[model samples]
Structures are given as C-alpha cells and as structure tokens.
Target: MSLKITFSLTASLAVLLSCAAKKNQQAEADCPPKPCTMEFRTVGVVFTDSKGDTLQVKDFSVTLKATGKKLPSGAEQSTDAANPFYMIASDGDKSALSVEGDTVVVSGTHPSSGQVKKTDFVISGGRCECHINKVSGPEKIVF
Candidate 1:
C-alpha cells in the first residue's frame, strides 16, 4: 500500500511540475521583446497644373511630427522648406506609413499608428504617408 501511494504521489508531482513549466513557457511566449531606435528624413514636392501637364511646385510646404520624446543627441534632423514631408529615426524596428488613394492615411510605429506592420503605403497627388525603417536617412517626395 505504501509503495502504491508513493508511486501515485510521484506521478502527481511530475504532472504538476510539467504543468508549471508549460505555463511559464506560455507566459514567456506571450511577452515580446522591446524594440530598438532608428532615424528618418522626409522631403516633399508639389505637383501643379501648368497648362495641361502637371509640374512640381517649388514653394509649397508641409510639416511632420512624431508623438514621442525628442530624438537622441547628435541625431541629425532636417526638413525641406519646399514641401510637406518629414523623416524620423528611432532605435526601434521597421516603422510604417499608410497612404490611401490621394491622401496620406497615417504614419508611425505600431503602437502609435495602430496599423499593420507591413502594409503598402499609398502616395497620391494630394497627400501621402511616409515612414522609414531602422535607419535615419533622407527620403524624397515627388508629387
């Protein structure tokens, strides 16, 4: 009887340990790693209706903003005074930009934009969204 009881207790202990380990693994899987930072830049060009063909206007401008803390020290930031566009570089993963038809849908990382990660950005004559990946660099906008 004692032998049987010991065996049963051992089996129960083993099952409990296995369940605990599984739960821990599940928790770990549910928690994802944090993201790094990157940088980006933007330039905007305007298209004007000159006679019949569309020409790029050199006097139009737009502004871009990010809902976060200021960029890191020594990080170069620039904007073209001739168009409506901007660039950002954060120590995070790939950022996103959304464009729908002739309008800019949205722009930013996942938590900020609340959009998909790898959606194709649409660019039109009116407005557009632009986001860069992990690197802070220059992006030219052609209207």
Candidate 2:
C-alpha cells in the first residue's frame, strides 16, 4: 500500500512539472522573437512662422538632456518638400536610443531671423515599441 502511495505521489509530481514546463513554453511562444518593425521610423520637429509658412531650420542639434550626449541626425528627405523639419531620433540608431523615458533637447536657428529656438522632448523607443515615440513635444514650432 505504501509503495502504491509513493508511486501516485511521484506521478502527480511529474504531471505538475510537465504542466509547468508546458505553460512556460506557451508563454515564450506567445511573444514574437523579433517583434520590432523593420521600417525606418523617426521623430521630427517642424518649424513654421506665425504666417503658417514652413520655415527651414539651421544648425539643428539633438542632445540627450541627462548626459548631454548628442545623437546622430536622421537622413533628410530631399524629395519631401511638403514636410521639411529636423529629426530628433530614429530607430535606426538601435542601442543608442532607449525605450525608457529620455529627455531630449532640440535646438535650431531660424535662418532668416537668426533666432534660436530650443524645444524639450520626451522620446522613447526600443525592441518592444520598435519605432520611437514622442511622449511630449511640439510637432510644429511656430516662430
């Protein structure tokens, strides 16, 4: 009788372990291995005047507020005349950018007016979000 009881307990333990392993495997399968998007993504700030004219900004720079590390600028779309602006960050940067809340400063000089404008931005991105997200920032800056 004792032997039968021990066998039953052992079988139960094995079943439980098998179930737990299956559950873990399912959880791992639920998430895609490469969930991030391959398409190029970027966050840009557009500069405009009070007249609503799209103004080109010069001497544009993007810097991380905490470390004061300047990030690389994204490629400009020369063919995109409709939307001329400065890129703050891009997913192409990979590890350089993090998904965690990061404060970024974007500054540029108005070509004609020679006026410099600085904008604070909270941007985030990484494997999960894939594309960068602009948490807080003016999409268009009116001079």
Candidates in order have lDDT scores of 0.33, 0.76
- lDDT for each residue of candidate 1 in 1-143, tens digit (9 for 90 to 100): 99999999999999999999998567546444545334343322223232433332332222123323232221222354443233222212112222222122222222222332211222321112223322122233222
Instruction: List, residue by residue over 13-81, the lDDT tens digit for candidate 2.
Output: 999999999986675565467655568878887888889888777887888889898866542423466
- List candidate 2 stretches off by more than 4 Å: 1-34, 74-82, 127-129
User: lDDT value for candidate 2?
Assistant: 0.76
**Candidate 1: segments with Cα more than 4 A from true spot:** 33-143
lDDT of 1: 0.33
Listed in order, each prediction's TM-score against the native is 0.23, 0.66
